[model samples]
Target chain A: MTGAPRRTIAIVGGGASGVILAAHLMKVSGGNVRASVIERDPRIGRGIAYSTELPEHRLNVAASRMSAFTEDPSHLLSWFRNKYPEARDEPGRFLQRREYGQYLADVFAAAAASASGSGGLVHIKAECASIVQVPGGLELRLSNGTSLASQIAILATGHDPGPHPDRGFASAGASVPPIDCDRRVVILGSGLSMIDAWLTLQARGHRGEIVAVSRRGLLPLPHGEHRNPIKLDRADIPFGTELSYFVRWFSDLIDEREAAGGDWRDVIDGIRPFNQQIWRDWPISAKRRFLSHAKAWWDVHRHRIAPDVHARAHEAIADGKLRLIAGKVSDIADRGNRTADLVVRLRRSGDRIALQDVSVLDCTGIIRDPATGSNPLISSLITAGMARTDPLRIGLDVTPDCAIVNFRGEPSDRLFAIGPLTRGTFFEIDAVPEIREQCQRLAVGLVG
Target chain B: MLTKKGKYGLKALVHLSRLPAGQLAFVGDIARANNIPKKFLDAILAELRNAGFVQSRKGKEGGYRLARSPSEIKVGHIVRVLDGPLAPIPCASRTRYEPCDDCDEATCQVRHMMLEVRHAIAEVLDNRSLAEMRDTTNDDLDLPQLQQA
Candidate 1:
């Protein structure tokens, strides 16, 4: 009945992007494309990022802006109403991360159901262990020994945990699992993950001195009150390509946003959609230069806590429950009892520096080897020479359109990637807004 | 960025609604028009089918058609069918309603306020059909320009 049969697609990792990709593919194929989503965990959409059971952990972005689709920006807001029917007026409300997880699950389920009804069938296997390229498409090996051959594979595996730095801390002797413990836990990094760690610690009744120490020891700023009703204008600001120029330009832009009756936070949120374009616009040298010199400052300013979390963190600091310290870890020598003796160069009081000895916790956060994904499909593709890490070592090598670039620097015709894993190629890829766009584009590529 | 279900549900449905009865448009054609990725759109259309919104025809000259008229398919229904609840906060949601864990629902002042907001949001999302969204002018929903200081 047909000259060539339609090829099935296998999407590895059923996180937000993976599920979104599957759902989009089903729609684009008009139920003609056979597809399957392979996730290591039983829960498809609730990956490590959003799998938290805590209600206090909230989405970083506002619900109004976090629609599943850009065109239908109100979709998420709509869903929120049908479920809660209580918090609808609060546009700036932050929701429990666990509930968001449920929302994601619902989306995935709907997509799978739709696929089945269309005769296209979307199978979600909870145990795909490895993926290797076959002659026509891909050979996916599941943990249960079953395999599926498909024409296209999309790596939508989400972010891996942060890396564990080498040092005496690596030796797990007497080291209390940094999380859910009652100790004077001194976290080494002050980022969102550290905040998460802090929240978890506090929630678990860790009453000891919780010091979040870093080079600058800067705690993320709290979400400021929404001051400006005016949208930010981008046309007047000419984005410079050099790191120095970009920094200056961004600083000026912050001033501009403030002048428009908003804070730098508003400016950052306003530019969220254009971040990819801005990253792409810059030369690789500039992007790399940013990572080395400016990333820390940029991150502190960019990723902020919800106001409620920020207040809690601040109160903890004021009450001596948590201490934020700025210093350099000169050395982390091995000490007995799973603790490391840290030599720190504390910022000078009045231009005179002092050295302090403190026991430290490596709350540096989850380290995922970005060069490779934890998913079996990504691991297999890399081993098979179908994909390689980016030159910058930020993430996997992929084209702007999200195609996987092999060791030979060739974009795979049948394989693609998206979500946090593609951050190397697209700097703004970590957030949902960017990934949703990528999912849409990647789905179009599959059919086109 | 709309999730594949959010965008493609409207996309494939739009294409199918425009076509004559029994004539199905392939996923590729609809995706190109809507700028949705093919793979993601595929899953989204499948969702529409399962929700009893669309029907598919396999083999040659086969694709998908709407199960009901565009007028009958509300945008919120598709969203609920695909994305679950529209509200992000529990107190605002209608279908999966449970009071925030820390507070009592009956006496919670915040919960009562949110309920009103939820009703307003539902009025718009649940009532507006895909046919109406398709007909809406771009200018009607044009993104506000970033104002310069």
Candidate 2:
């Protein structure tokens, strides 16, 4: 350890990633570090994903896969068994998002309790408005007119759910309440958020027809019992391969599996552990191609919903209550009577189809670029030249260790980022499994 | 979530659900009608039969038949038998209850949401019988269709 006083690390955003990072830091720091978590919300752990008021929004991943600690993979599962004894034998279950949030809060609480006498963990219920580099540390200015100086700062603000991308649709102002139950609705994205909106509407007793439109309009696949534990060694992956070649290779592999009566999921799941490596090995152009061409397809297959949820979604489609349209919404116009029509260009024919009397819901997931976002903290950092967006513009630029890369192309030693803020560098940073591993590594690096 | 087995099984069961009560449908015919591979459909039907959703007989004129009336069998029940549980998460599952290991069941935010998801799913799948979904044409809309490009 350094021959200095205890180092203070300020983590902005007390979400899942921040909580997990603090817990790991407490375990490894050995009273050498004091951690202060700055959050806008009153409570920590329930980020945007888990803080939903609706109960119908379930986690896409199963229970067994959502452990906050990679070392104790069964931490969540064991907790579940202890709480719900009946489910002790069933490991392949998905829990509620809030339950996961509570678990995180509990884990953080335990960690904080243990570190009470040491450097200790402090929770500051305030938003970090800006961070400035100072001598031997950084100063974090909070929204509550307070400031804190720390030896290191970790940006874990997570993703921002920005407004709708289509200016015309957003201007239509269809999101207002007293929603017409009979009006036709068009959702702009076919991801999990789209499904959430559909479920929300259903819960609200909406009998209207819904048309979910996306560039690909590919809905998420259903989660089924995984029979095969297919293991792929590094040699099996086409590392350093071009994007086109890798796609062909992967397609052929899926074809081979299907031919042998095996599910394609086995292959996708098998390669999950190695995605970061493959993604890292890919050339810049290859990564771009992947983001442009294969992202939608990969999303649907990789992010599967529970079987019953799948059934309900399919049933809605089957009943003609919901429709999946593969297209891009070109424009939306309000038609004077609180109704609007969207001009959608079909993906295949490029023919414009006018969807009539429909309200549009923006479910295109969270914003990727923090620089252009409404988040004051992110905007402040970008403006101060303390952080810069990656070339892809998907997220902030960060080194593999999550050190913030400045505009001068230098990685900051005292400043770091984790979670969704580092998506541009690590493609799979949003999910619990990936984030937990990243947090563990970052904690070790920071403490060491 | 519908597994390939569950989907194929549901399709076959729906096909049977549409048939005259007590009449049998051959595995080949069901597979051909639904675009499911014959071998795959055979295994799926075998599972459905083992779960007591269907009864099969061998030899000429022998085929598979629903064990009960189509209206009596809920899609949710079939899905649970073929797939596993209707609940998105284990803790919210009624038929297969399993507590998550990480949080307080009473205070977990995720369980509350999942419970609602399970209820929504159960409302749709459990309340609607196979007979009710038998005539729905949207079932095959996901199948590949020619599009003008």
Candidate 3:
């Protein structure tokens, strides 16, 4: 190891968050610190979402909003133009995800180049397997059986695949193979992920029927045209401590927005900037109190769908290619060769039990329960008492600055986290704006 | 659906895996055998070569061979080398964790929780090698587990 007094930082998981963080640190550090990216895969950037080769896999967000660095918001748009000049006419359009992945890779390449040319090395190791926090810093185990020692480490792990369902009946499910392409698939959730799965099945030429089941069966709201906008007057909305009161206020606000000719997406998007603050400022008891009753509705309102994607989903629904069922799954019986029969309980009806044959796909969104996380590092950290799960158990609890809090209610000096995993702490962590804000703040604190 | 690149790359790799060691297979042969576009497969091969997953011998009898033994190389390695990190989010990614500059990874609750996801993904990719992917199985009962899962 090179002996130097310089601070060496090791970053794990080279996804969007990691790459952006690295880029920001290099820009902000101005060659004072050394940063190394330890990626388990041989690829340095281009995480799963952007690595698609399908041109139809457009990003959910517009190209104008996907710059790697927050300060240079137009960077991605400019890059897009240079890469695909034919799409110059549409500025706010969702570009293909493959193009976005290339853009991110190019951004990281430039950052690494700048850091290297400046004599501040930005080492991007292709394979980092495990990391252990040490006395002075952190030690990362590489796939090649080597270890890198650094003073600080950041964990930017990316998205988790959906959860696996429990054991069920053999006869109840006979139409869908566990992962068959032609099976009558029953998607467990009705969100963006479910849309992706449905689209994927269609792309694969799977002609079988698709069923999306959720408790509410509430499909995502579509992005509306920027016509007659519904502007909410927050002045009249009385602040209330009770969950029912807040729900009543929100429902009324929704009604007003729709009446004003503005789509619900507009109302939700308009409130997003202040959403986290509202969650933070609200009494913790009230916030926890809302989880049981109002949270599901809140999620549907907040995470809207792309207009084109929504239209496609609606077309599928209208054509009967897709079915939306509002019910809780009671049991699933494996039939044979990727087929299953399921028992469903309607949420509204008291005693209506429906039995049907379908394939089940768990598109329940990224696994929220950190307790069920299959990562050894996280399990070790929790067992060693370095981190504590939040009251909701969706994720770990951290202090405002994002330091992981231990069971005794103390923040760890050595440990840190970021990204969608903080859903319990921050309601709006998945979007680009919040992530950019987060990357900026975290880089500053680390450099400072 | 896996991307065209991934699908083609996997097919090409599987085809390569079945061939005798050190024997060069032509790009045309790989493309024709797999029914992948010759032009697209060429580009993918170039990437695989540059990424050190494939070694090509350019000549009349030349095609491509595994840079490493089939058992040693992982499908994840080829995908990642040709593509990028397995996970998209910083928190779920196993290898690269540059804390978003705007937030403190140490103090950020979101990042902390994502660490679990990142490790889980990293563990799967890191543990599984190409050699494992090339092992052929006729067991129809073998649920082709998306090992990445």
After the best TM-score superposition of candidate 1, give how far the Cα of residue A290 lies from its true spot, in angstroms. 0.8
**TM-scores for chain A over all candidates:** 0.87, 0.93, 0.87
Number of the top TM-score candidate: 2
- Full ranking by TM-score: 2, 1, 3
Candidate 2 chain A weakest ten by summed lDDT: A168-177
Report residue A32 deviation for candidate 2 (angstroms).
1.8
Residue A55's lDDT in candidate 1:
67
Per-residue C-alpha lDDT of model 1 across residues A312-414, encoded as one tens digit per residue:
8888889988888787666666655545556666765423232233345565543345544344556666787888888777678889988889989989888
Across A1-448, the per-residue lDDT of candidate 2 in tens digits comes to 5565798999998899999999999999988899999987776898777776566777888888898898888999888777668754566777877777888888888889999987899889998888887888889988899899999999888877655344433311112235689878788888887887788788778987888899998989997687364555443354444566578767877887788788988888877887887777555667889988899899998888888889999998999998999998887787744357789999999999998877767677664668877678887888988899998888899999999998899999999999988888888877999999999999999895
Task: Mark the regions of model 2 whose C-alpha exceeds 4 Å error after superposition.
Answer: A1-4, A85-89, A164-180, A334-340, B1-149
The CAPRI class of candidate 2 is incorrect
Please, what are the lDDT tens digits per residue for candidate 3 over residues A216-278? 898877765652333322222222123444565557666777786656676566666656755
TM-scores, one per candidate: 0.68, 0.71, 0.67
- Per-residue lDDT, model 2, residue A138, is 88
Query: What local lDDT score does residue A324 receive in model 1, on the 0 to 100 scale?
Result: 80
